[model samples]
Target: MESQAAFNYQQQVEEIRLAMGCDFVALALVQSEERHFQIRWEFASGNLSQRFRRIVLHSGKGVAGIVFKTGKPIFVPDAHQYYKKEDMYNYPILIAEELESFAAIPLFKYNRVKGILLAGCRKQKCMSIEKFELLQSLVTPTFGPYYSEEVTGI
Candidate 1:
């Protein structure tokens, strides 16, 4: 049986993909203690392939990993410009999904980076700054079993 939280993550990704008209939307979650907090691609929608399942991300490595380690969002208007063709291979999701533009946000829980959310497109710069901001806002403040501890307006 699928866990409710896992189910919610899938549903949320699908909803975000449709609402944003994105080519791909995925969630990377950190595994619990027995798993050593390893980050893995857990849920996704609009993906071109299942290659993400074969990938295991480390902190500060791929898009999700970087966001996970830094606790800051990463917005790449043009993946090609932002990352060299060779460097592109470093991000499994980008290569697997053939993403040309993308944005990754860190999901916080108890003030620590706990998960990652990514939205992207196959076309260059398709994920615009405005759209990126909107994406950030859409997932803001809360997610299942996780709540952003970001400091907001006074």
Candidate 2:
């Protein structure tokens, strides 16, 4: 069974998706230390399918991986313009969600990146700079069990 914390994360992701009017929003978290800290999407809203559950990522790999590895955010205002045809396969989430634009932010804990929160739009130009800034403002300092920025302690 899923824990309450996990359920709450889903609710939060949904809220963010609704607020941003985005096509998709998801949260990827690190697995236990025994699992070598692998990352997987644990919560999602407006998902196209269950494929995301099957995908596991390591640091510096996918969108979540990049944000988690660098503890910084990434904004792809235009997926078609940003990624080449050959490299499109590298971002499975984008393809899965049919996203034309997207952004990801690092979720920090104990001054380290422990999760990633991603927001995406299915239509090009739907994810504007103002929307990205709104996303950043919404999650700053802390959001649920994670921090938008790397900070010491809670």
Candidate 3:
């Protein structure tokens, strides 16, 4: 896609966050050839800190990285209960974004994970499976070059 058109990434993420009433929404994208596939949060909404923007994740380090490596979706409700605080920092996006419950879905292009779209809530257990499913449905089959694997029959 043209870089100009792609600049709408932040706008689209914010729209999704508002529509879902999520506390935070962010998009993580793999850097082009210059960065050798390193991933970073490219856009965010309702962010608590800028720490996430400085983080450059490898292919399997954190949630977005893991999703990119495995080409799968990840959901964590009640992050404090699901992950210890010490370990939680590994996911800088979660920490800087102040996400308590979150889901990360891979955005695919040509059957490869190109980026991740994340939605989160600051309140524990605020993101239900139904909402997660809905979010998945909403982005599937569309969303720039990213398509949900489940809907793509992959």
lDDT (C-alpha) at residue 87 in model 2: 97
**Model 2 ranges off by over 4 Å:** 1-7, 140-142, 152-154
> Relative to the unseen true structure, what is the C-alpha lDDT of residue 7 in candidate 1, on a scale of 0 to 100?
39
- Please give the lDDT score for candidate 2: 0.85
- TM-score on alpha carbons, each prediction: 0.87, 0.89, 0.88
What candidate 3 gets wrong by more than 4 Å, as runs, is 1-7, 150-154
- Model 3 lDDT-worst window of ten: 1-10
Per-residue lDDT, model 3, residue 154, is 45
State which candidate has the highest lDDT: 2
Q: Against the unseen true structure, what C-alpha lDDT does each candidate score?
A: 0.82, 0.85, 0.83
Tell me each candidate's RMSD, in Å, in order: 3.3, 3.2, 2.5
Expressed as tens digits, the lDDT of each residue in 1-154 for candidate 1 is 3244453678888888898888999989977768867889989999887888888988788988798878889999898888888877788889899899998888876677888889999999899988887777778533665654455564
Which should have the higher TM-score, number 2 or number 3?
Answer: 2
TM-score of 2: 0.89
What TM-score does candidate 1 reach? 0.87
Cα lDDT, model 3, residue 134: 74
